[model samples]
Target: MSSRRTLIRGGHVLTIDPSIPDLPVGDVLIEGNVIQAVGPNLQVADAEVVDAKGMVVCPGFVDTHRHTWQTQLRTVASDYTLSDYGLNIRLGYSSFYEPQDAFLGNYAGALEALNAGVTTIVDHCHILNSPEHADEALRGLREAGGRAVWCYGLFPNPKHHPFRFDDFDPSWRLDDARRIRKGALASDDGPVYMGLAPAEVEKPAFEAVAEEVRFGREIGAKVISCHVAMGGHSVHVRPSVTTNLGRALLLGPDILLVHGNSLSRHELGMVRDHGAAISATPEIEVQMGMGRPILGAALRAGAKIGLGVDIVSNIGGDMFHPMRSALVEERGADNDVLFKNDQIPRRLEFRCRDVLRVATMGGAEAIGLDSKIGSLTPGKKADVICVRRTSFNTMGAWDPEATLVHYATPNDVDSVWVDGRAIKRNGALLGVQQPSIVEQVWASRERLERQYREINIDQLRSTKGYQRENYGN
Candidate 1:
């Protein structure tokens, strides 16, 4: 019908815009890639209508760091500690997965997110062992029909020895990153953007990582993300005060640090001074025993903050669980107003909606996409998701906002649209068939697992440092 003039009529709209305040009873008029108008209603002329009578329309959720390829390997690494998890699951099998398998897994993962009402995802695809692997992952993410950022990585999320600094070619990596953006990112396509993840910050020599970061900045790759917050096996023992703080000292406005927990007050201030963003994966922090402490530190430092699923391999995948867990855990620890004054401000009292902002607007800022996406501003892209207020998960909720944070599930998402195109409508995908995509992903995982059993994995248990130890565990 009319791509430029789709009317999302009749909903309690949460614009997430302070200027407009709250459009409790509202309608959004989307024209092409941007929102044409947003208000109660002006006219019902030539526009094609998507009835939003019983929906809570808000800006789409933005997942800052997610390993989309791991959708097939879910819970397979459940028993393995971080070290063993990589040794047995990620590198053990993921390294062996065909490019086609990655495509299938990414497809399934993107659709799952769309079905769950996440309109945008930053797929930090680091398993780029080959150029084809990178391209295939990009293809799957784009074709899956949602807004995504293909964050090409220099290192595969290692399950073994350090897939560290010296293993990759920074020159080749730079060219590949450039190629991905020029060939893929430059395309006037739907819902997909391209950037680069610098892999690990700690293991890489300071100069090498700094060069990569500089290269990314030069290419106008607004976001330069690092897996810095989760205190890895190495960080826990020796503890890096220099590199940890030194890295922040080297950062600029476009950079983003993920899981930034260990930074002291001065270091936090350093990050904030740079105008950088922090992505905290609340669920995974608790699971991996990384200590859930981002909320207090980042805010206190005055840094822009966002929430990520980190990787889809755990409860991190869904926005609902992460949002709930972030607020509940933070508030649980704060206890009272006295604690709030110390950590969070007494005025805000560590809000649920503030976390929602981090999940959306703040996330966009982290990725350096605030101007184009994230919020449902008039001129901004119509990247939006509809959570069903009428659903069993949200019914009889006198308070719309609290019920959404406390009760809404992935199933409550009825529709998702990215850049004016509908990806998931009525709980199903648009271009890709969910069942078939998931089947392909599952079949690929089976084949990979079988191949691993035949070729390796028995030796996996023998690998030095491959055990159930954590930073403390």
Candidate 2:
């Protein structure tokens, strides 16, 4: 290990690991990228001491799925439905992206998440319009210095795109995946890993889907993420693609299904039995009329559940919003079912801590990073965060987990560390030029917005673009 050592002391620690009990005043010793010890007190001679008094020390939050390149378009789709998103983002703005735009967006998004104490992210990058786009996105992640899985995308290019694709071959996607797996991400033990986000079932036939899965497996992808059973009615964006793929996809433990808003109990059970996990973006799913959030349903069906902020284009990027949304949505849904039978719910089946677990451990498990992160274990990676409870909204932090999940916001995050490196200290990103990042994102957003207007936004607002593709032949 390097000579660098950090000692975080004098804080209320919530380990989140069952093997260790919560400590009212604990100390954590970190050496290099891994934690050395966690206890009531630790005496270390050659270490930089960080006083954590009046703070809640815990594991950093993990987001299983985020279209991070869409960070610059934050809140642009505040009122957009699933169909509207497909029309505007998938087919419009996404078509105009240059590699630099992908870099700035991904880099800015990574920094944004890090500033908010999110140490790990699964960047579901479907805007890989070119080979250079893939390189730029991975570079952005590495430059931003966060743990991530760059899920290489295979979404088909739209015919109406202004970008020249006469020479673009779909086969290049496979070659790029191979290159990334063998070259850019040869070792799976780094802070960033390689994963695959295959094209939706419609674009890729059953054989293609099988090929993608086999390719991912052959390359030992850390995770194969898919958006399944989401939205009201759209084959291209949110239809029950998983139901169509069924067991033929050969999903294993490496697969992580996102959304699943419309997934049946049978599908959920199949995922659970196959050791696959589900990442539910409760806020976006609820906002887009994608039926109820599947937190309770997935949990009851014995599937591992995780939380994600699906899109910054519509909802906030903080994990708190999704956690809170999941909790209340499930309780409200339960109450509705009880009232239909003329009965009242005696109590909520899920607690605040449950959602917090979904944000931390469940999320880590979703991306297969739980053993190294998600909890402040002695042997785990030092992906830790400290939330100052002195803020007006989080004062009197009698309950650590409750205050974190319900009351705390990104503003309360005082310090964040990933792999023993301080990324955010004293509520600001360390060594990051925020103004430059902002400037780049703003420029990219302006260009994307100007280009998107050419695609006729009014038409997108008036109708669903990809809904017709749902007609199964």
Candidate 3:
């Protein structure tokens, strides 16, 4: 626990908790790592006071899914398709990532999230090429000092050329998972904790998926996340195999399904009834033609929804874009359904505040941390951010919620706190040597590119035609 006490005074606080009313001018008292009080005027002695005038105070954003290790390869897959992503990045580049490279990517990625007011993340670290890679990735998340679930990936890439890929045996995977649980994450409650990213049932042999998921639950992982029902590629284009795997194993609150682009409405209901959550990564899903963002479908099916950046390799690493994209995409979809019968939609089905919920509290619920860090409630962790409402892009904030959804960017973020500790202040991150981290990332990228110089960009692009023909428009 921190000995320092902090008081954030006089700001418009969006608690995100229904029990706590919105405060136009409020004071939040933070003692140690927990918020002690939130009201009009809370006085506490020996506290470092932070003046929050003219700022919009809110719970920090939570990213339910992100390929954080791909951060160093940012934008490298900008124009790549689903199949291209599988072949090139997942299978190709991920083969050469050293433990140091994983450290560079995850460390930088977590810091990027903090800088953007994303206080928590479900980092889908799929490149556990070796035991050392897992160690380095966990270290990176811990060193970055943010709340996260370091999801240990169990997916096998069988297509990486020049390297004979082998699938992780279930016994080996389960044993190592237990080892990490007992060793690195024995305490089970820290800013960074263990999660499982098992191979989805989409892969063949349904038993493998069940085995891994059972192992995750047995190990007491805080969450279990998986890529599901994402179809827009040529190789295997039928849709997720959750239906084939049968319903007996898919039910649970600890499961978080990513993408779900091709899930039928009934499948979504199954997820909802099972108390599972969906992480709808609108930017990547829409761009890669995986399917329309599934936020609308998930909501309609009564499933909890969370927003994610998915792959910084192909998109921006900020929550703003995903929130805005989800809002617009859902609205556009609603309009499409209404206009099909030559009738204009009477009203908007969703609002800016709704998307903001998906970005904040919804994410907390998705990862089972709703009681801890998703709101500005008195007992919640002090994971909060202050967005400058008077900034150039967000000036004249008529509706503060709309301003956050549509206008505010990362640049408008003024201060950020995770677990009552200030990580960013006055628009700059504290205690981080930015230049050294940047240098390390660049060096790692340079080495990978130099070694893998023979990868044919033209050949990779040519697969688009095959995808178009085989998978259709």
Candidate 4:
């Protein structure tokens, strides 16, 4: 038997690997699922050739955190704050989700990511209303044909019972998580790996949180993610989640903390020393009043940092928004200090390339897949994307990294490949009935909207206030 081969020819290639120099005009040869070679004018026989002229070929973006289950609720919470999201999407809209809704959302969301050149994601799905919901969500991810760490959410759905701030059972969720680990997600080498998204650290008891982390490790989960140090909650809650976890000696490299906007410098250092990473979703963090992004702090503390979309319900799924948002926010913060000191800034400290790295290599490192899919280095998996440099939005690109970070959009993505397979070619997704998926998602959205309006919004708001007072949500 012969191996399959694809030769992507003649493009400006940005291999994120530092050892490999960027190619002004280059070819990436893929044999089977791995990158066979990357250089100029690679000669190969009996291979399918893809013309990459007028394209910017690079490693596909890695989104370290996303609530992909909210695909059907796009723009439903565009004006929502962190509290509003909890009350409306989490408590209100989530009550009407059926198993098919979970499947459709994940499936459509993963496709949305692929369309935007995000080849891999850490799906922080917190919509597990039942074990069947878990199964369907995973099924949707698999069917979408993209790479992901489907972090099985342990957060209890409000639909299952009245929203509880403190008292809730994790025993059943843990059992189901075990079942998922041993069943479909037994192997880490698969396109989709198993991860754990435990309940929010502040809402749950310390002992229970520690137990969840231990159970994730015991089951050999690829990553254990948690929401920590977000917004006003961090200011009100004493002894940050990092401090608590560190005191108990539970912090490890596998832990990926999301939205640490209020994490102090000391806490950031602690995260670095303990080998954990942070995922910053800049747009949502800023818009939802989660405070300024922690990118600047995390960088100063030398913590591993990645960029994420967070939720499509309020923002777009593409990595462009987060990349640009992070870059500008950090630069603006630097300028503010200069202005405060009665001095004009001479140079920008945060570079466009830095945020681009956060979207690709940094994200892969955050999710612990840097060795496999972060770069276009030979021997790594072939997860790559080609953007149309000739497009009006991206024309006359001088610095490839800057062009990508500042100007590129999902529509400019010409092609995408994952595991050497062409998931998107000629600006269209492959092997999926996109129209049918969109129709189903729209139907789900309509049904959810009708059901949500029937719920007592005033009562939900009161409950939100109660939770805020008690659990510091």
Candidate 4 — worst ten consecutive residues by lDDT sum? 159-168
TM per model?
Answer: 0.88, 0.93, 0.92, 0.96
lDDT per residue as tens, model 3, 234-306: 1263434555433656558888888888888888887888888889999889878878988987887899879
On residues 1-473, what C-alpha lDDT tens digit does candidate 1 reach at each position?
65568888887788888776567678998888888888997486888888888788889888887888888777775555556665665556666767787787787788777777777887878767677878888888878777887777876533323233224344566678888778778763446766678856565556666777767776766566777756554465333532444554656666677777665677677777777778888877777766665876687678877877866654436787778888977887666545656755445477877778878888888777788777878999998877787777688765556756788888888888888888777776676655766677778878877766664555555444233212223
What is the Cα-based lDDT of residue 231 in candidate 1?
55
Question: For model 1, what is the error of residue 250's alpha carbon versus the real structure, in angstroms, after optimal superposition?
Answer: 3.5
Measured by TM-score, the strongest candidate is: 4
Question: Which regions in candidate 1 have their CA more than 4 angstroms from the true location?
Answer: 1-3, 156-171, 187-190, 232-249, 336-348, 455-473
Flag regions of model 3 displaced more than 4 Å: 1-3, 157-161, 166-171, 232-240, 244-246, 456-473
Model 4 clash pairs are none
Candidate achieving higher lDDT, 3 or 4: 4
Better of 1 and 4 by lDDT: 4
> What's the lDDT for candidate 4?
0.88
C-alpha-based local distance difference test score of model 1: 0.72
Off by over 4 Å in 4: 160-170, 463-473
3 or 4, which is superior by TM-score? 4
Query: lDDT per model, in order?
Result: 0.72, 0.83, 0.82, 0.88
RMSD of 1: 4.1
lDDT of 2 by residue, 1-473 (tens): 45689999988898888899989899988899899989998989999999998799999899998999888898788999776787778867888889998898899889888888888998888889889999998999999998998899887655444333344467788899899999999998969999998876544456777788788899988988887776454435333456544557586788888888777898888888878888999888888887788889999999887899988888767788888888899889889999999999888888887888889988998788888999989989999999999989999868888888889999999999999899988888889887877888888899888877777556444433343333333
